[model samples]
Target: MERKKFLRNIVLVSLAPAVWLAACKDTGKPAAQAGEQATYTCPMHPQIVQHKPGTCPICGMDLVPFDKNNKDHSLTLDNSQIALANITTMTIGAGDLAGFKQLNGRLATDPEKTTVISSRVPGRVEALYVKETGVSIKKGQALYRIYSEQLASLQQEYLLAVAQVRQFPDDARFAQIEKGARQKLSLYDQSDTDIQRLVQSQKVDPYVTYPAPQGGVVAELSVTEGQYVTEGGAIMRLEGYHQLWVEADLYPAEAVKPGQTVKVIVAGWEQEPQQMTVQFINPALQSGSQLMQLRGTIPNPENRWQPGQQANILLPVKSKNDVLTLPVDAVIRDGKGTHVWIEKSKGKFEPRIVATGMENYDAVEITDGLSAGDKVVVTGAYLLYSEYILKKGADPLAAAAGHQH
Candidate 1:
C-alpha cells in the first residue's frame, strides 16, 4: 500500500502540468473567438487580412480594423488622410448658369494696322538705319539712305532754277521751273527739312535719307546694304501692335454675328481679360476645314501682346436662371463613364454617375443624378478614386453599376 501511494503521487505530479495547460486554453477560447469575429486588413494591401491586429504580411504595414459585415460602395478616410490629400468639398445649389463655348484662338497682327515701307525711287541702298527685322521704328525716324544719280540731277536743276530766279527776278518761267523742281523732289520722298537744308547749303546731296512713314515693329527686311531696288520696291514691313486680332475657329453651329461682344483671355496673361468686339466672321468656311473663322480685335496699348501666342476665346452661348452647376474639376470621366464623388457622410465618399450639359473652362451644368444641397468632392477627387481602388480591389464605378442592376 505504501508503494502504490508513492506511485499515485508521482502520476499526479506528472499530470498537473497538462491539466493547468488545458484550463489556460479554455480561458483563451472566448478571446480567440472574439478576435476571429473582428477582422483586420492592411490599408495599402487589402488582400492581406488577419484575425487579429498585427503587421501586414505582404507590405509590412500596420493592419487596421475592418468591418467585414459593412458592405457598401464607399470610401472612408481619416482626418489626417483627408488633410494630406487636400480634399475639398462644396454643397450643390441652384444658381444662374452661364454657358460659354471655349474656342482655341491665336493672337495675330491686324492687317489694317500693318504697313509696308517701300522705296519711292530707283537707287542702291546706302545704309539701313534699322537692320534687324524686329526693330521698333517711330514716325519721322530716319529709315535708310539711298544714293541716286537722278536725285542729284534734280537737286542741280533746283539749284540752277533758284539762281535763274534770283538773277531774273521778274521772269515767271524760272519761278515756275523752281516750283516744278521742288514738286519733283517732294514726290521722291524728300522731306521739307532736307530740301530746306539742301537749299541753304546750295549743294546737291546724292545720298538722301528717308524717314519712316509711321511707327511700328519691323516684321521683314527686304533690302540689304548695296542692294539696288526699283521704284515702289518693298524696303520693309512693319506691324502696329496698338490692337491685335484674336482669330479663332468656330463650328458652323456656333452662330456669332459681327459686332457682337466676346471675351478674350491670353494664355500667359489670363488675369487681364479684354472685352473685344467681333469685327468679322467669314461668310464661307475655312479652306480645307469645316470650321468658320471668327475674328475679334483687342486693344494692346502697351504692346505687351505678340502674335502667334495661344489664347482662349469665350463666346457666350446661353444663360439660364436656377440651374445646377459644379466646377469642371469635380467631374471625372473614365472608361466606365462620367461620374463624380459625393460625400454621403462625414469622411465617407461614394461614386455617382451624372449627366452633364453645357460646359466651359471652369464649370459644368449638372443635369441629372444629383440635387440641391448634396455635398460634392470638388477637389482631390482623383486621389479618393485611387484610394478606393486600393482598399476595395475594384473600381467604384463597377460596384455602382452592379448596384444599379
Candidate 2:
C-alpha cells in the first residue's frame, strides 16, 4: 500500500509540471502572421490600388496575383454581370465554311454592243416606224421619215445637172458639173435606191425614209413625228439584244477578277440563268458605295432583260479543307496571346493559347494547342476569362475555387 501511494504521487507530480508548462505556453505571445489591408499599391506603379480589385496603375491592365499556377478555363464571374455574345461550333477534321460575302448589282446591256443611230442631216421628222424602245426592227427597216431642205436642195441641183448633161452631152463643163452634182446628192443621204429612183423618175423625192442603221433592238428613239432635229441628231439608239449584260458590284478585295466566271439569276424570267461572258472590270471602285463593277454579256433575243434590273450573282470562292474551325466570337485576345476558354466538363474551363489561321468574318481555323475533340466554351467564354483573371490571389482558388474538371 505504501509503495503504490508513492508511485501514484510521482505520477501526479509529473502530470502537474506538464499541465503548468502548457498553461505558460498559452499565456505567452501568439505567432506573428502577415496582416491584411483594405488596399495596396503596385510595386511597378504605386498609383494603382483598388478595394477588392487587382489591376495596374500605369497600364490599367489587370494585376496578376503573386502566385497562380492552375491551368484551365473554369472560372466564376460576378453574378450581376451579363455578357451578350454570339456562339457557333465547328468540326476539326480539316475544312472551312463553304460560303461568301453577299453583294447586290443590276442587269444592263453591253455598252460595247450599244449603237446610237443618228440623223445625217438636219430635218423635220415626218414619221417614225419603230417609235418606242424594244420594237424589233429588221436590218434596213424604214425607221423614220425626214424633210430636209439641205437634202432637197442637193437633189434639185442634181436634177438640173442631169437635164443640162442631156442637153449638152458633148460638153466637158456639163459633164464635170453633173459629176459634182451627183456626188453632192450622194452626200445628202441618197442611198442606191434613192439614186436609182431619181434617175428613173427624173424627179427628186423631197421627203425621205431613213432605214435602220443595223439589225437589232430599238434601244432608244430621240426624234418624234413633226419634230425639228438638228444635224447629227440622235434619231434612235440601237443595240442587238441578241446578247445581254450582267453587272456585279463587289468591294476592292471582294471584286471578281477579270477572268472569274459569275453565275447570275433573273427572277421574272422562268428560264435558267444563262452564263454571261464577263467582258469588263471597272478599274475604279465606285465612290459612293466603295464597290467595283464586274460585267458579263448574255443573249437577250426576246427583250426580256431591261436596263437597271437587279440581279443576284454568285461567285464561288476558293475552298480550303482539313482545318480546325471555331465560331468567330470564341477568341479572346490579350498581350499574352490569342486564347480560348475550353470546357473540360461542366463548371470547368482551361484557358488555352492557340495558333490561328485563315479567318473569314464569321469563322477561324485553329492551328495549334487544341485537339480534334476538345469541347470549347463558345458562349460565356469572355466572362469566364474575366473571372479567372480577376479571381487570382496568393491561393488562386478564391474565384473558381470549388470547380473541378
Candidate 3:
C-alpha cells in the first residue's frame, strides 16, 4: 500500500505543471508581431481579404495591401497596374463644349431654282427637239416646233392690213389697222424681225419654233411630238444644276433657329466640305417622325453635288465659351445618372455624380458637381468601371448616398 501511494504521488507531481500552464494560457485572439498587422485584399476584387499575403481566388492576381487611409468606395491602383490599363487623366478647366453637332441628311433639287417650261399659245407639237429627260439645253436654244392656226391667222391679218395701207396711203384708218395687227403678232412671242419677214414674204408659216428661256437640264418631258396642247400647258420640267438644297431632319433636342451655319460633306465628292446658313426651319414637328425639317442651299457650279445623294451635315446649334468641360469619354451615364471619375490622390479614384448640359462629339459640359482644376479620368475609364463592378458586384452609382452631391 505504501508503494501504490508513492506511484500516485509521482503522477500527481507530473499533473501539477500541466494544471499551472493551463491556468496561465491566453483565451483571446493570437497576437501579431510588430509591423505584421497589415490586412491584404485583392486589387481587382476588393471584397476578398486575408490576414496574411495571398493570391486572389477569382482572378489569380497577387493580393495587395489595404490602404486604411483611403475612404470606402475609392479605388486604388499601383503604378504597374495603371500602366497595364493605360489609364490617363486630365485637369478640368474652362473651354467651349459646342464645336459642332453631326447629323445625316440628303441632297435635293432646290425648288426655288427649278423651272417649268410651258407652251405660251394653244397649238399641236409639230416636232420636239428635246427627245428625253436629262438633255442639257442652253438659253435661247430651240426646244420644240409647234403648229398654231391662231398664230397663222394673225400673220395673214397683218399681211393683208399692210397691203391695204399701201393701197390707200392717205387713209389713216387703214394705217391704224396695220399697226394694230402688227402688235398682235408681236404679242405671241413673235419678234419684229419675224413679223417683217412675214410681211415681206406675204405667206403664213404653219409652224413656229420656240426657244428655251433658260439654260438647264430637262427633268421631265410632258408632251410628245404630234401631241396637242392648250395655252399655258406644261411642256417640260427644267432644273438649274448650278445649285442644290441639302435637307435634314432635326430632332427636338437639336433644334436651332434660323441663320445658324451648317457644314455639308457630300458623299463621293472630292471638294472640301461646303458651309451654308440654315435657310428654313419648320414651325411644327412632323407627324410620324416627330422631327423638324431644315434646309441649306449649296452651290454646285461644277454639278458635283447631285440630288438624291447622301450628305453629312454639322450644325452649330449652340455655343458657349468659358464653361467647364471634359472629354466625352470621362462621363458615364446609367439609370442612376451621369457621373465621372475623379482622382482624389495619386493612383486613387472616386466617382462623382455630375449634372451635364450641352455635349458635342469630343467633349461635354459639366454644369454641376465639379470645380476647376479637378483631375479627371480621360482614358481607360471604362476599364476602371469594370473593375468597380467586378469588385462590388454592383453598379457604382446604385447607392443613393454614393450619388449624393
Q: Which segments of candidate 3 are over 4 A away from where they belong?
A: 1-98, 169-172, 252-255, 317-405
Q: How many clashing residue pairs appear in each of the predictions shown?
A: 0, 13, 0
Candidate with better lDDT, 1 vs 2: 1
Candidate 3 versus the native: TM-score?
Answer: 0.55
Candidate 1, 1-405: lDDT as tens digits: 999999999999999999999999999999988856867777656667777789977878787775665558898888999999999999999988777878899999999989998988889999999999888889989999998888899899988998999999899999999999999999987778878998899988988778888999999999999999998999999899989999999888887889988889898787687898998888898899899998888888789889998999998988888888999999988866888899999999998888998787678899998999999999999898777755665566776777656
> At residue 268, what lDDT does model 1 achieve?
79
- lDDT string for model 2 (1-405, tens) is 999999999999989989999987776534311223244334334334554556575766655442233443355333244234232233345566544444566777767767788887788998888779877778888988889888878888888888899999999999999999888777767877787788789776778788876777787778788999998888888876666678777777874667666666776652475565567788987877887887877667677777788777766665567778887778766544677766555444556677787675457778886888887767766655545544443111222233332
Q: Model 1: which ten-residue window has the lowest total lDDT? A: 389-398
Kindly list the per-residue Cα lDDT of model 3 for residues 68-136, writing each as its tens digit. Answer: 433368779999989999999999999866667788889999887788888877899999999999888
Question: Best-fitting candidate, measured by TM-score?
Answer: 1
Task: Give all candidates' CA lDDT scores.
Answer: 0.87, 0.68, 0.83
Candidate 2 wrongly placed segments (more than 4 Å)? 1-102, 167-173, 217-219, 268-273, 320-405
